[model samples]
Target: MVKLFNSRSSRPFRIILLVIAAIAAVAACAHADTPPAIVIAPSPFAWSVVVALVVVIIALLGVFLGMVNKSLGKSVQIKATVKKTVEDSYARKIRNEYQAKQALLDKKIEQVRQRFTMVMIKVKNLLDTLDHKELFNAISNLIEVDIGASRYVIFLVDPVKHELYPFRWQGYSDSAVEKFSMSVENAHALTYALKRKQTIYRDAATSDIELRKLLDREPLSNMLVAIPLFGKEKNFGVVHIAAFADGHTEIDESEIRFLSTLPTFIGGALANADIFVQTREELTSAKQVTEHEIAEKRRLQEIFSRYTSAELIESLLRNPEKIDLGGVNKTAAIMFTDIVGFTAFSSRMNPKEVVILMNEYLSRMTEVILDYQGEIDKFIGDAIMARFGVLSDLPYPAKNAVEAACAMMEELELLSSDWANRGLQGFNIRVGIATGEVLAGNIGSSRRQEFTVMGTTVNLASRLETLNKELGTRILVDEATFVQLPRGVKHQKRENVRIRGLDTPVTIYEILEQVKSAKIVSIQPKLDQLASRNNQSTDKDALPDTPPVAGIKRPDN
Candidate 1:
């Protein structure tokens, strides 16, 4: 048996014999060891108990073996189940973490997209309006409502005036807003932004004392942003925004980035507004200047009308440069006419009556002078000094003067008759005429000047006027004047008289009337005819000696 146990050939048969021997040996031992007492022919209950014990013991043994086998199998199954559960739980945990991360990333992306979209919309809205007030209101609305900034202010820089004034504001009262306005030179933050041409932020650490103080004074956030309104040439101004209105402050990076691009639009709007204001001002100034010039001209016309005839005034106005404050030497006829006994006549009447009479006589004489296109130099007491051909070149100045003198004497008759009807004294006037070179133009101080003749010609005219009283004549002409008279105009020769201030005796003439057949009643007709004839003769080069036509008389002198 030992050999079989050790050998591999009879292993199966030897294992079966060994099992049978061990069982027989156990049965022999059970047979040899007997109990001390035994029950024979036991009762049914006792016998049943014994059998039940056997069954119980067998069942107990079977249960023990089955329990061992089940323990091994359960251990293996529990291990496998535990491993599968652990692997599923770990994988599920990793999946949940990935899902949570993806969800969070999607949420952040949506927020960023929404923020960008909002900023783009706001930027588009900002450019829609061009009105200054509207633009300011729109900008304020975007910052305060859309951009979520609580407080904001817009400052426009006036480069010409060198000032920065608050243009618009939000979240502040009128008085408070007024306080924020300051000069650009004094606003340190604004100045820095403008100088750098960039955006700047002001906080506790910023090195701007005035800005810090200003922030402290207003109901603004501690964190403030200043964005320069950049222009093509320079910065227009600044837009100041505050982070907090009245609560905790938070600054969004996107908001700042968005706002940094808005000043280009604002700058363009401001430039247009400024140009409009300047252009309007210039137009207003130009209108004022034009009105002033018109008023000045009207005033000048009124003043000049009082000194000369309307015709002379028109001529002077046409050539205003000729109305200078100096003298020009020219050949002209100066006539001096006065009441023959004016001193005696005035003494006999009251001052009022004398003025009336003098004005009456002077008015009639002035009418005759103006009718002949002569300038009344001045009215001296009851005497008149007039010049012919000073303002306009007369065809014949001496002839015009002679004709004016004759007309004056003729008109006096009607004037005296009217004065007689009014019971005013009637007087005769002595006239003197001289033709020579005289300084004729405005002459006097800057404050006041008179357009009158000054020279020996004027003096001689005065001397000749006095000779009328001695000669018992109403009209007298010096030799220089008499030679210019047309033969058709009737004049009588007077004796040679040495007038005062005259170095030599002057031949004087007494102008009477015009020859009736000649139809030369006044020098005006003769002058017109003369001008016509000269103009025709000049162009045709055919000078006619007989005054060009039969209707006109020739100057036989």
Candidate 2:
């Protein structure tokens, strides 16, 4: 009972009892019928005790109310804290669910993005190739591996015959591929795709009889996809894919969509290949034409360079019209060279020896003349006639002629020493040069023509060459040639010289040496060595104890 009274439920009853006792006390004090002894005049101490008791009850009630208010506030705080904790836990669960869904969504998006990028890379590779074989191989690998096809064949369209021929194929024998040909008139999948210019998908269980019939001629397959390759201008070809090898009977929507996009790329590749082939053929033809032109130029050069200077041959080749059977009056320097004592030399030898000696002499003289830009006009027996400044204007024709003469003399000296060493007879040569206006061109009939120069200049040059024998000189130039000769040309003036065909005597000069620039310095040591050998041989043969032969003369003598 004490615990009950002290409990919260008993506190309000105690306060109610206290209020009734205070009221009863006050009423008894005011009533007149109450006992006088019991209701004696209330003492101050008694009144004070009653008042203190009331004050104590009021204070206890305030304390109880304060304690009740504090308990209620604590309960509300605990309830609010528990509610907030529950709410936070629920919100965390919801946020975790949202984040997991978002993460899954992000992973799916990333996977799709990667797939798209890979497909784009494959498409780019397909488009970048130009080789037809490589392109077909790439296409086959893509269809078989990436697009999940088991077998495939690429057919090229022949516009002329309106036929489709297997160009590149997989999962088929060479003979089978060779025998595969379909006409556009035929009811086949390739033809159907080509006519429709779209991708056709046919399954074994397809309800459409027409589609089934179109794929009947193809290899035994449960599913067949035919894509027509169309170029910018016309239909190029078609690609047929079969799904029979890997137990795949049907193509999904994504695979079908990917197959649908292959025609554009394949068609573009085919068009580029055609252009490449056509361009290669054109380049080959152009190369052939250029080669023929070069060959003709070389042939002409070989033929013309035999008789004229290389520079003249080049000019004639550049302007082909210049080579005609005609004559032109041009100021030129004419030079003639003849072997000294050739008749006596040949009479002492056989025909073979004579020919060999003449060839050697003439070849040496010809080289020297051409070296100085002089053209070999003709070979008169053991003589050579060359012309300078005939095909083109030369600033120093006289100098060229004199220098050529000097070179020829030097070459002959080397040849003479070489011949002495070889136990062969050697002869001297004479050169004559003259400068004047001459008719230079082709000078024979159409059937047999010769390019030569003719006029007073030619006659004068020949006459001067003949005059060398009498003057005991190697090279003689007429007044016209001497006057034009540059300085540093060593010469001896022979004034007022009479000629066989001239009315009056003409001035001539014997060319002794060439300028330092035109001299052949490299061969000097070789010439000197050969000369020393010849001198030693001669001295050895002329010993004091050896008697001189009566009929035979020394080779040099």
- Candidate closest to the true structure, highest lDDT: 2
- Candidate 1 residues 437-479, lDDT tens each? 8887777878977767899889988988888778777677776
Q: Over the stretch 1-557, how does candidate 2's per-residue lDDT look in tens digits?
A: 88987987566568766776776677566554654565356556665566667767777876787679679879999999999999999999999999998898777556545655666677678677644455566767666666666567777775445677776667778877767777877777778788888788775325677776656675323337778988777687787776546777676554555566677876776665542222222322333324444455555555466776545665655555554437787778999888888888889989998888788888878888877888888888888889998775665576578777887777888898998898888988888898878887777876977778899889999999999889898789876676444433566887688999889777678877543425433444543454445543443434232222221122221
Error of 1 at 132 (Å): 34
Could you say which candidate leads in TM-score?
1
Query: What is the alpha-carbon lDDT for the whole of candidate 2?
Result: 0.69
Clashing pairs in 2: none
TM-score of each: 0.42, 0.40
lDDT of 2 at 163: 75
